[model samples]
Target chain A: MSCWETIADYGLRSIGIGERLLPRSDFTLCQQFTLIGSGLIWNIYFGTFALLFGFFLATALAVGKAAKSPFIRKPSEWFIFVFRGSPLFIQFFFAYFLFLSLKSVSPVFDPFTAAWLGALIVLFLNTAAYSGEIFHGALMSVPKGEVEAADAFGMSGFTKFRRVIWPTMLRLAWPAYTNEAIFLFHATTLVFFSGFPAWQQRGDALYYASYFADKTFNPFVPYPILAGYFILLTLAIIGVFGLVNRRLNRHLPDAQKGRMKFRPNVIR
Target chain B: MFSFCTDPQSLDGLPWLACYLTTGKHMAFYASFGTVLILLAITAPVALAFGFLGATAARARFRPLAWLGKGYIAIVRGVPDIAFFLFFVIALDQAFEWIRHKIKCPDWDQPIRQGNDFVVCPAAKLPLSTSPQIWHEIYGFFLAVLTFAIVYGAFSANVLYGAMRAVPKAQLETAEAYGMTPRQTFWRILVPQMWIYALPGLSNLWMILIKATPLLFLLGVEDIVYWARELGAAKQARFSDYPHGDWRMWYFLALLIFYLAFTKLSEVVLARVTARLSHGQATLGGTGRSAAP
Candidate 1:
């Protein structure tokens, strides 16, 4: 079959659209790339939605962790600690089974029995914990001098924070937050592996890559194609975040701007 | 384990629970945690060596070797590590057997690639294909360790490379001025001081290593995750003593708590080690002691 015919059939294949059967034999390089590239759609779906929703929860969590009350602060601290400390693979397994049991109890959790909802929820919470920790660190490190200045100007707590502290905290935390985003993107692959069924032959990029590898008995071709797609995705992330970093630090002098170095120390 | 456990079907309450937990497969499940710990113990040193060599190669004077080292560090980081884990284990297995095939059966070769199957000469199979069950398990484990070493080695290379750069340049120059050779300077000044810079990154890497041990399940080793699922599946009374509903949630919860406690203990120990290493150094952790008049 022509590559275009292959693309037309499998392009939306990951979401269970046009194609019912995956290419089973005599797998061409073009077929491998097309199918795996189609699978990239799920990676994007999981990463984008989880990140979008996770950011707000992370912000709330960071604020809660920084709160004066022990009740608020302690839960946030443990939430971050529990999620951050455990392997995300285990979290997926735990969450999957937990949700399955919950579904027996109530229909409210029925959506979570599926991979799209359950796996996404786990990723959301997992990324929130890591990013929350990053933001909490930045929140603590917001310059004391700036707060003092706000107090001297007769600015109240809410006004002072809204005007000065939150922006600077984001500015300080953006570099590390960028790293967490990239890792979380990398982590979406774990969903399929972690007992969250693919529902069909439909799976993510690594899923399709491994599929071709199993069929062709050649590890060299499909895996690299998957890697190539991920590299492009990673670069795209850096590009988008770089733009945000610029906007965040636009008011700062060159010396004051904290340049985003690709330090990989932030927890996965 | 109890005398009352003689009749598993007859026992009830806590004794039944006790007997269930002590079943043969459940014992194997517990042993799988040890497998994870051993994988971590072996992979850490192997990965460190790979990282050390990679960093040294990155610092090599030869251009191609330097590029190769740099590329290894970069490309590995850009892709998801689980992909590498899946790819490298199979690729390495094939490569080893293919080499064995060529050497052992020079004239007897039917094509190794028969459409979709990867066939090799019978004599060339890893562990001889006739070894005991334990030997096959060991071979699978050996491949897993090598795969993890290659993947995480790239990560440690990145960490150590940055740590190497973090050491002050003037120290190297000062050593040269004191009539120290480059090799001597590197061994004495650079290596000794590099630990302080490397400590934070290495500490983070250690936590990552602990978290990554579970990936052994994906690599087809009977690690904790595999056993958790296997033992927790619903069992009928006819097949086994432990007839139960799907209890995977409880199994996974135990695994989660085990990891959290393991990480908590490591955090405390790592903190103490950091404190000791920072003594008499110039970093923030050392300032109090190092400022002594």
Candidate 2:
């Protein structure tokens, strides 16, 4: 079949669109590329949504961790510690079983057993913990002069945080947060490999790559394709984050601006 | 195991719990933790050695050698490491066998790649295909260790390269003024001073290495994750002495707690080491003074 036909057949295959059954035998390069690219839709989906939602929680967690009240601070500290300290692979396994038991308890949680939701929740909590730590560090290092200047302008409490503290914290944290974002996208590959089942052969890029490897017994082809797709993803993340980074540092002169450095954290 | 633990069916309360915990599978499960520790113990120093070599080469004057080192460091940065883990296991196995195939079956002319199958001569088979199961496990483990070292070696190389550059230029120039050779200057001045800068990154890598132990399951070494899944499945009364419902959540919980404690202890020890290393140095962590001082 032509590459165009293969794309038509499997373009949206990962989300259960177009073709129902995956190509069984005599796999073409187009088939591998199309199917693995289709699987990347899931990776993008999980990474985008988890990061969007996790950002807010991460900010809240950072603020709470910095709070003076022990009640608020202790829980945030422990939450970050527990999530950050453990392996995300184990967290996925434990969360799946936890959700399975909850499903047994009631029908309300039935959707929680599926990878789309279950694994997303695990990634959400995991990224939030790591990003929260990054933000907490930034928040602690926000210059004392900035807060005082805000107070001098009659700013206090939430107003001071919103106008002065929040922006500075983000500006300080963006470099490391960008690193976290990149690694979080990479971590999404572990979803299908972990305990959660990918229903109806719908899996992520790594999943489809592994499937092709299992079929062809050739690791050389599919893995490099997956790596190519991820490189593009990483580049795209850097572009977007770099734009925000420029905006964050817009007030400063170019020499003083913090550039987004791509320091790859190999694993979570 | 208590004296009355012989019959699990008759036992109840704490006695039943105690007997169940002491099952043969539980022993293997416990031993698997040792596998993770051993992996860390072995991989850390070996990966550091690889990193030191990579960093040294990256800093070399020859352009090709520097490119080779830079390429090695950059390879792991763009891809998910799980891909590396999965890829290297199969790739390394084939590479090993392919060399053996060429050497052992030099007279044979059949193509090795025969439509989706890697058909090496039986003589070229890893572990000989007739060797004991233990040999297979060891061979698999050796591949895992190598893969871990390769991937993490890149990360450590990046850290050490940056740390090498972070050492003060004057320190090396002083050694040159004293008529020391470049090699001697590097060994005496650069390497010693780089450690203070490298400690924070290396400690971070160490934590990452600790957390990554779970991926050993994917490489098929029967590590903790494997045992947790195997032992935690619901057991029927007809199957064995221990009958229980699905307890995988609890098993994984135990694994989680173990990692948390391990990481926590490492953090404490690393902090102390950092403090000790920072002493008498001129950086912020050292004497709380500016570099100018």
Q: Number of the top candidate by TM-score?
A: 2
TM-score per candidate, chains pooled: 0.97, 0.98
Candidate 1 CAPRI-style tier: medium
Q: How many residue pairs clash in each candidate?
A: 0, 0
Q: Chain B vs. true chain B: TM-score for each candidate?
A: 0.95, 0.97
RMSD of each: 2.5, 2.1
Using lDDT as the measure, which candidate wins?
Answer: 2
For all candidates in order, the CA lDDT equals 0.89, 0.92
- In the range B101-128, model 1's lDDT, one tens digit per residue, is 9999999748998888999989999988
For residue A154, what is the lDDT in candidate 1?
A: 92
Among residues 3 or more apart in sequence or in different chains, the pairs in candidate 1 whose N, CA or C atoms overlap within 3 Å are none
lDDT of 2 by residue, A1-268 (tens): 7999999999999999898999888999999999999999999999998899999999999999999999999999999999989999999999999999899999999999999999999999899999999999899999999999999999999999999999999999999999998899999999998889999999999999999998999999999999999999999998999999999999999899997776665258
Candidate 1 Cα errors over 4 Å, as ranges: B288-293
Looking at model 2, residue B180 earns an lDDT score of 98
